[model samples]
Target: MAEANHGKWTYCVDLAREEGRRRTRRRGGFATRAEAAREMKAVLDGELRGVYEDRRTTVASYLREWLAAAKERLAPNTYAGYADCVERDLIPAFGHHRLPDLRPKHIDCWVAAQQDAGRGRVTIYRVVSTLRNALNAAVRSWRLRYNPAKHSVPPKPRAAERTCWTPDEAAAFLRHNAEHYADRLTDLFEVMLGTGMRRGEVLALHWSDVHLMDRKLYVRWTLAAVNNNESLFREPKTEASRAWISLSPRVMAALHRQAALQVAAHPDGRLEGLVFAKPDGLPLRPQWVLDQLRKRTAELGLPKIGLHDLRHTAASIMIAMGIPIAVVSKTLRHTTLAITINLYGHLLKDSADEAVKALAAALDRADAERGASESPLPLAA
Candidate 1:
């Protein structure tokens, strides 16, 4: 029913209850009676369809509820990221607004404000993504009609180009490590560059997973840091990342050296501990490894590259050696071939040119053969 009260229209309707109890839902402040009636009809329709959303739920409450549910299902690192964005950014921005009252315009204004505040594009993108994801969940649960943040999210930031070493540069760096900084890190760097293993995967490696005689190792765990404060061992990044990786001779050599060093450091240590650990037998911090890499690169007067760049450098070297992209993808343990292509497509330019040239040569030979076969033999007689 719709009524006029104080120059505004109001609508009231009884809500369907599962139990034998009557409940009423009412709304006011529409400019016209028709608008109020339409809204009432829509609410009735939604209730009939079992998708009625309560407008009383604030964004703050909904997000908090959603986060609590998300924590049980999401990975620790992933949940930490979501929690940080929701509590530090999203809730602070629009927590007062009702979930049902959220509009695309509101999301757009927030994105613009973030941009004006000189926030990093990647940071803004991630926070908006968190909002969009939470709102998507609300839409799926019928808590909201639609996700207002869906179309209003900022564009994802492009990955920055990574600096990778050439074969000579890599060789020179390894040699320098061997001569000057000959320690466990020397072997660690050798294993990283040789196998293209991720920092976490390498750090989480266990001696039991390595087979020196067979020249292979299994990737089972990855060490993840939560908020850069605490470390935890988690499953591999993907199922493919858990598969066996064939070790190169250089990698095998590094492992042997690491084994010797481990024996000298801890004669009574068990074999079940981490392959790469500090003196206290705890996993080495990823940040500390990066810091050492920076310090060494600066000392060597080489272009500064992060530890992850060693993985890229390995992929580049393999691609340059005419290795098949599929093989390279498998070697790198990429979940998909497209990922390898996307990351190293620029390096495939020469290979692509060679393929086209070979095709052109074959076509030219076919054309010449066809012309010779069609020529008249009488001229030669």
Candidate 2:
């Protein structure tokens, strides 16, 4: 602070690192020293209030922290996805803007820009949802008046119908697998195709989870990355996810064969080690598996799809083959039958069409039997 001149105040704030080095800082000017002091005090108060957050914290900054905390509570691979959104998409657009200053129109405009920039509707929807949730928390805890992100209408996501592999497509993938990555990864793929287990679930498998004697595999956990420094093994996302999946004879056989291979290769045939480990017996990272899938798809000239679609494809194929929906839902370890029906209901509708035809045929047979059994002479009707 500088001495007063003619009762006018002059003051300066030191914006320096903890080590005592000074750096360029934001400055304000006032007419009186006392007034300057007051202004500085107010600014300092606001900074202290937002310190847990950063000074001049914006929607984007707190969102990053919220995302970090949320990531800590989620599985590793899931957190990686959320972080990607925070870094590459959300922060770039709204990082510096204050929360209170944001308006619905601001969010709407940003959403439009993202759509114009070629981001998928689903991706944009997630970005807005993530921001809305973080700001909602701020409103509850941080003196924020409103959640502007929630005030804006979420951009409509384009309808994304599941595209499962057809029987022929599945056959091609299986044949390719057998030819190239046979015995090891091929068996794993077959198990996924047969049981509709997610990639993470399949990879997270342990010999203990595989109840071969009971013809079921317990889906109790999934593999995920929590952060750069750790991989987390987490329970299935939903209670419904923690169910038993009945396996077919072929699937059981494949798993048995896989177990034997693991025994011969891994020390003590450790059933507790990761189901899918690296050649050197380390846990396989999920991204590496995804990369492998992508490369294989490119080589085979097949349309690129997510590993999750393999689960959907398995369910869809079974539905097409006249498997009951409830069984399929259980096999897929879905939380609700509604979810299974929503995703694969169209397949079920097709099945229903066939069922109706068979029902009609039975009714016609009953009518024929009644007419034939009646005594023609019964009377002088």
Candidate 3:
């Protein structure tokens, strides 16, 4: 036993041997030398008896191991995203910090710093969620006694207003698209808006995924761009993402026209795999798509929206038309109806006036029936 006086407490380090050569140093703090020695001895005995093995591993080291095991359970794209989040956002902030010393105050300060660095609430939320889950895994493995993530409160940004183009506005946008982007790009955008397919799903589409005879688009895979270098195909984010979307006549016509144009341009139908590929017949890059959309919107002087806003627009149109929430949820491939409702609940509330009218009509019918019954069934026979 080695005793040292540090700060206000006496520290004792006990050397204990377990099995043949497994040795460990048990450390503890006490007020007096005798008490420190006794506590250290007890901890050493527990260590030898395999009761407590303090995993003195750091947060960074454990995260690497956790990521390795977690990757196997997730899709390739998801794994890549998680890896990016850890490497870019998490490691720089907490990698060197002592895991046991982390506190809620520390997390709050770090989150504020992140916000100061211009990280949006959505990005910060994702980072915090990833960090929390990583720490949670450590807790489950007994590496940690408490999860600091539970104590941290990342700011929640207010939800943005939902804006969807009306039917006439949709037509105007399509007409402008036909006039400006007259090739496969126009068709691809139209298909996305018409079918409510995600951007990745639209990029992952292949000739085989389309069923002209059945007039359906099979959405089973998505194309993800990693590090802006290569595009890879992976399973959709959720189970509900794998579905069949009925193609509208105009959208089907556009796809068919694009197919003919591609066959004519490439001589071999550009059957290089993807339905919406680059001009050189390679997979479309997400950034390139965004660039095109941005330039086109600028040229047309249209309302500027992100690529994802197209998806929101589709969902908004459905909600405005009184589509059932469950159906919209399934169409959007959300994990739950609650998510769909939460995203578009504001729009649904606008229909409340009609709902009140329905209740009033029901009451009127009941009152009319009651009055007839009380009027003495005059000459009913």
Which whole-number lDDT from 0 to 100 does residue 291 have in model 1? 93
Give the Cα RMSD of candidate 3: 6.1
What are the per-residue Cα lDDT tens digits for candidate 1 across 138-255?
8898777778998988778989999999999899889999999888899999999999999999999999999888999999999998876799998986898998989888888889
Write candidate 3's Cα lDDT for 1-381 as tens digits.
334555334444545545667555545445556766555555566555544324244667767888999987877676787788788877887877666556667778888998899978888887887888888886777556678988675766777775566667666777888996687788987887888888889989988888877888898788888776778788887787888888889879878887777777776546436788877768888898898877776775677776787888888888888888888888888888899878888778867778999999999999999988885656766
lDDT of 1: 0.89
- Candidate 2 weakest lDDT stretch, 10 residues: 46-55
Model 1 residue 307 CA deviation in Å: 1.8
Clashing pairs in 2: 9-32, 9-33, 76-224, 76-225, 76-226, 77-225
Residues 274-300, candidate 2, lDDT per residue (tens digit)?
566777756667676677777777888
- What local lDDT score does residue 235 receive in model 3, on the 0 to 100 scale? 85
Question: What is the descending TM-score order?
Answer: 1, 3, 2
Q: Which pairs clash (backbone N, Cα, C closer than 3 Å) in model 1?
A: none
The order of the candidates by lDDT, greatest first, is 1, 3, 2
* Per-model TM-score on C-alpha atoms: 0.87, 0.73, 0.79
Task: Give the poorly placed runs of model 1, Cα more than 4 Å off.
Answer: 1-45, 377-381
Q: Say which candidate scores most in TM-score.
A: 1
Task: Single out the weakest 10-residue window by summed lDDT for candidate 3.
Answer: 1-10
